[model samples]
Target: MKPLHLERCLRTVEADKAVLCSAARVPYYPLVVKKARGSWVEDADGNRYIDFLASAAAVNVGHCHPRVVEAVREQAEAFMSYTAVYMYHEPLVCLSEALCRITPGNFPKRVIYGLSGSDANDGAIKLARWTTGRSKIVAFQRSYHGSTYGALSLSSLSLPMRRRMGPFLPEVYHFPYPDTFRPPFSGTDEEIADYHLDLIRRAFADYIPGEEVAAVIIEPIQGDAGILVPPVSFMKGLRSLCNDHGILLIAEEVQQGFGRTGKWFGIEHFGIVPDAVILGKALGSGLPLSAIVAREDLMADWDAPAHCFTHAGNAVCCAAAYASVQVIEEEGLIARSEEMGNYLMERFRALQDSYPLIGDVRGKGLSIGVDLVKDGKTRERHGEAAAKICYQAWQKGLLLSFFSGSVLRIQPPLVITREEADRALEIIEEAMRDFLAGRISDEVLKTVKGW
Candidate 1:
């Protein structure tokens, strides 16, 4: 295959550097997208590639989906922005009702909208603190919530996100997240779960009493931390502990919700209902929208204007979100996610037998991770190799990204066809082969700073 020449893409990247803030960029490759539809994206230079990153797992229903596009178009034509804080809008109400219906909770639920995952998480913090009359919040290490102050305080995924920024929210605590593959404590799956849960239990008893903790925020499937999916016992034990202590359990479903995990939400896989669920990435099918679905009482106590954004429930964005939800249900994308996720995992596991670089394969549904390591036994992170694979895959006409230094995140849009997925798998293997054969060089990595 001829090597990709992204001249226009490179030029566009240069333009971005000249105009865009460095703080806003975390680019893995010079993939200057011109147009995207369904599972394919075309570059500025007219080169086409399969989209596996799904715009950082936000386009679950696919890019430019007709239903979502039409909803945006129609809503924009009627009116664009509305001060949802003070005004009533049909779209907002409709979207809220839909969220209440779909989210994992049998109890009465209410919805709060925001423009991104950051603000939604921020809102959840305020509500959790206010409702419980407690100040402390607990989050997992290597878990990402968002960049906003409250969310940032809860996040400890990478030091770069927090460097020189905090003095974060006081009383916010971090604990070990159970990682079965790289068990934080040396033991079996059950032992690992108990060990981590015991740490939290000990913290409640020795240091911060659970009574003082307002909430424990968690990602059902930690997205930015290399798609770390915790064991069921850990999650269940955490929930029980929260219940015993009266600390609210907030599920940050920003990246793993809306059928991306082969269910309505990732928490469903564990058969647990969180006190609140934070949603964002795919809620609007690529539009700027997020939501917090919580129990009615939790939302009721926190009155209006206390946590309101002027465009929190923007009519157009709500329309897009509503249509996006419909697309997931009508197109049966949730089930498709499970089926394709299994197929992709099977194929990747088969490839693992041939590639020592593949150290671990783990995830639920379409939210999978391919951990790369220098030595399989030692399990040392091979960020260099992961970067090379991503670069090679991009050059070979596939779009994807790596996170936590070395895990190849394999979350494509749920609408991806089997044929596209097979081709993507082939490109991934070819990239690995290219890396082992020295076709991908260290020089190629100088420009990209992937996380």
Candidate 2:
């Protein structure tokens, strides 16, 4: 795990073209990770980087959390896979009950498990359609549901993920997401909400009928779309509209759920309850596990076997998820996320004061985004600068992710302490300063600006 070993790994990656090199021009960061513990990941070169990405927000409690690892180990020794066809397992039932208890809504709820966010979303779609006897679904633009066909069709982000697939599912509609950063309407928050609602009403009037629409899926905080936090009024307005129109509201919390947004469910931030909640990412503490928790009456319409996965509630994943939930509660990670998020936001705002390239800095809890722009007036994307900053931060023993072309996404593990957060802020500031100082090439700048 010396520096030489790390350089060797990077060389191998270069030779093999295995580091998603085709998508991005830059070579991947040098440091092949050896192992991770808590909030730190060690490269093969024996350098430790504070992991702000948190494995794409899947490890909220931190890497190798003792409780979660122990649960997985104990479950592994007992039994592994049990096909959903024959018998029901205790872990599955227990996890379902736990999810029902924690999810919003005082009414009785049911849970359906899956191995990934895509599968859970697929299940949610089926459940919505079956319950309403309708086929049409509405999703926001720039939102990411998953990569699979049904889920990808719901996703309206990058065209590469959906284009050429041709002939996606019918009756899927897209609406402008309430992006205040690039406001859909130039007005107050209430006006923006009303404008978006009008857009939805017009969609229903011109395209899909209100009764024909089965569900309206939304990510309370659009993650892959660059941590776009919609106005509180917008969310509440949507909820009310959905209720009045009899459209099921499906909150896709794949990236922002499970304490990532300082709440068990991001929709809770608006104090509105959704009809169905899709959860993944941090639910299993790094293991692949996802679920759709819905009202019992609504879920009852799903035809058996057709809507389930073999590993829907795999024993080990359920155990890990249970342990993860426990760790979040027992350790008070949700409160910690709020405290740390406020601290990070304060630091980020300070950065904005010093850097004109930072067009906007916003988020809730530990889920945050620092948006980069070429000139403060134009809001021209400075994605290249953002990428350079990410690379520089990697060089300085920090790891983060970029989204929405120009957003520097910071989703550190919920267990991240204030000290660790300060360190991450320092790294980000240094990277931003370096990019502003012409340390990066003009060509690179143009590349990020999408010029």
The model with the greatest lDDT is 1
lDDT of 2 by residue, 7-93 (tens): 755675567565464533433355566899988998766778899989889999999999999999999999987875568788788
115-149: candidate 1 lDDT, tens digit per residue: 89999998988999889999999999999888999
Reference-based lDDT, each prediction: 0.91, 0.84
TM-score of each model, in listed order: 0.99, 0.94
On the 0 to 100 scale, the lDDT of residue 254 in model 2 is 92
**Residue 204 alpha-carbon offset, candidate 1, angstroms:** 0.7
